[model samples]
Target chain A: MLKDITIGQYFPGNSVIHRMDPRMKIVLSIAYIVMLFMAKGFSGLAVGVVFLAICYGVSHIPVSLILKSLKPVVPIILFTAVLNMFFVEGDPLFQWAFITITKQGLSTAALMSVRIVCLIAGTSLLTYTTSPIVLTDGIERLLSPLKKLHLPVHELAMMMTIALRFIPTLIEETDKIMSAQKARGADLESGGLVQRAKALVPILIPLFISAFRRADDLALAMECRCYRGGEGRTRMKQLKLTSRDIVGAIIVALTIVAIILLNIFFPLAIA
Target chain B: MAAITVEHLSHVYSQGTPFEKTAVDDVSLTIEEGEFVGVIGHTGSGKSTLIQHFNGLLKPTSGRILVEDRDMWADPKKIREFRFKVGLVFQYPEYQLFEETVAKDIAFGPSNMGLSPEEVQMRVQQAAQFVGLRADKLEKSPFELSGGQKRRVAIAGVMAMNPKVLILDEPTAGLDPRGRDKVLGEIKQYHKTQGNTVLLVSHSMEDIARYADRVLVMNKGKVAMFDTTENVFARSEELAAMGLAVPQVSRICRGLAARGLNIDPNCYTIEQAKQQLLALRAGKGADQNA
Candidate 1:
């Protein structure tokens, strides 16, 4: 059950998106999200949707996987849509007592939901294409400018990379502990809310202890290796921008321009 | 009647996904009551997965597991009863210790069995004694104990339940030689005094040779051989092909047999090899005197 979490999961592939520079992918993802919100009318949203569809095709990631990433945010999406539908004021599309669903409200709700879905899909595509190590490297390189202000950019990136590396290890340990407790007749399933919370005591205490132990071991190992605050460390694989990254950046720029032009030509219906 | 019976049992992990794998496949075996059966296999050969089924921890995808002539999954609600009947001490069980005191950790299983508090305390003391834990250490927190002592406390936790069959998966793994021997000796003593079935899963052929009366060899999720310890070691070459080795003494006996000695090649223990060599020496001495 703990294995179902796919956050920050990278799928290994040889597609163009996978080959693009990590920094370029990260920048392009931020740009995509910006354009999604900047989009004013149906035409702009359509352009964003088409752009995502093309990215999905080029990345070769299955549609089902992209949909699965949205599972955890379903409630948030529904809440936002419902709020927009009831609150936005305009000509009434349907009237029922004080709760009137206006034409503009309905349109705004649809647009908001579309924008949120596109936002999630675009960001997940970035994680799906770039490995965590490369992503951290990209972030460290991008944030290196802040080093002049003594912000410890490299140290932050190193911590993130280590955290990502240990996620699966900790998950495996939890699974083993759960099994051990179950063998001792600890009923984790089929209980009231209070009973279920009580059952977690057996699992949580051991997990926390092991996690602390692992952290101590890791710190000792790092010290033994003379690791001192990520200074003077050189990467074996330096980041290089290739033709694919240049082409991806150009496409993102063009999409942003197109969204702006579409918004100017076809004004939003809600406003 | 057999204490446990596995009929054409097969298990596939993550079925219908791309990562699906047949961890245990079409395997079948029967273990009788009061018999000590040692399961030996290379890593990922289904040794752990198979033992988990004995206590209904894992359900077979294609076959059945019977504990004392009753299907383990016949009544899903009663699966907890099987856990009480078959105690499983998983690898590195020390990490499972969570109680504040060593005594409470040991009593976890017995209390879960709904026994009276006095009976739970009695079983806790007995289990701790079986693992050679000193009585004075019972009041201390488990985390305060040493590594080996923590492991003993974990084992006692399972033993307190007084299962009819005890299954240990590499109970001696990651322990020093002395610690390993202590744990194995306690397990042997448990089996001897309780006179109940014990299934020991290990990768050390020597440990099995010394303690197990019967050996079950698993290769690529299939039972390669299941027979007496002597017979299993006699086929050392076959075991070697499966990336397993026999006891050092058994290897020496086979080496001597290859050199045309009249000694038995199936000697699986040091005592057996010593007796054979002594008899051979006596025969030589008599021939010289004659």
Candidate 2:
């Protein structure tokens, strides 16, 4: 049933974070990702955690929802943690046959897991809070300055918006296609890997054809509506960086600064 | 025993999410064997959702669907068997036909059922015959067929399975009147020959009245009414309130009845109206001549 797919999901809200100019939010998200990496020692990681906590609190998005998004990536997180714990060479903390857990290895494992989790969480918050339309609109405007370099920013953004908008459409189409094939006794979920993959051909072929047809129709419809490449296309809602966005950016920047200073000035306890 | 029995079924889509919605509220119905049942509702009235459950295509959020008294979801793993038992033709089924040749496409279901190649070939020919697909067209690529033909071929894929309960969700949709009649005629013929239960979900009131013996009117995810065509069409006002119209001819008859005509206001078909009018005229003539 492909139930666990959480991509392109949005959380509708009236929080200050949700209302911010998506352009400002996008840039701030980048800053937050950097701050996550900058955090090294325990003090530094603490600052990163507090900053992420503040962002989450302001967004008004439930903690459980964020944790739910982390479900799909749990195995990856564990893999990274285990790899760091067992592979990194340092003073041995626990010697168990061939695999040795070192003090530095454990610390690296902990910090890396935290960094990866925070990175995913921060990026996801932007998507979860801001509607895809607004996000794409902001991206188009931000990338407009690059049009002189022939970057096709408008086209790219338009494509992204259309793709984001059609995620549900495609999912519904897939469900329909699955049902259609199922009526014909297509046993998609059962069988071995090869059989399963073969079964998906019926679904995938129809889906691909339909997607292409939809794109063609959408293009024609866009032309009919006189949507000519974002040129002179005035948005109904203009993007403006509010005080909340500026304040959020400032907090994130300060956290990064504190992490850098902590790494520079303090000796690590584990070391 | 009825071919299909739904017992107090309810469905909530995306349950527990902020965008959660209840599509079908508690609805129970029994579709008698060999009877043609039409499910009519406004868009999102859960007609589609309800039909999906009847065939085991969808697992109900709560409640049971019984195909000849056997629970549909008793073993979810064997849902494929249920599908063969209840053939579901989804709207725009042509889009689902992926095989290269018409014969191959029609044989998909029987082939998937692990039938022998010879039996699948026989079923394909029989299914094509049932849908009135020409023998010459069997070898052609499905993409070469016209819209209506493609729909038939898609439908034939399921019909090839020889299901006991055949359900079609808007089989005649997007087709011209001639095309619609062709498809409907085939469905009625299929029911007559197969002696199986037929559940048709459609938005067209006329189509339902024309073919279905019993009509289940869905309104806001609940069974608003379940009765014979004559009775259901008689409650035109209630249907109107639910944003559904009575059959076209019945609407006209009701309008005429309201304006002091001694016509049968409950008649929903053209043939019924004609017979009633002839009787009315005969009665008037008898009075005048006497």
What are the lDDT scores of the predictions, listed in order?
0.93, 0.88
Task: Fill in the DockQ of model 2.
Answer: 0.73
Clashing pairs in 1: none
Native contact fraction per model? 0.71, 0.86
- For residues A107-217, write the lDDT of model 1, one tens digit per residue: 999998999999998999989999999999999998899999999999999999999999998899999999999999988887899999999999999999999999999
Which 10 successive residues of model 2 chain B have the least lDDT summed?
B50-59
- List, residue by residue over B60-122, the lDDT tens digit for candidate 1: 898999999999999989999999999999999999999999999998889888999999999
Model 1 / residue A194 / CA error / Å: 2.0
Tell me the TM-score of candidate 2's A chain: 0.92
- Model 1, position B128, has a per-residue lDDT of 94
Docking class of 1: high
Worst 10 residues of 1 chain A by lDDT: A1-10
Question: What is model 1's DockQ versus the real complex?
Answer: 0.84
Task: Give per-residue lDDT, candidate 2, residue A146.
Answer: 97
After superposition, the stretches of candidate 1 with alpha carbons farther than 4 Å from their true spots are none
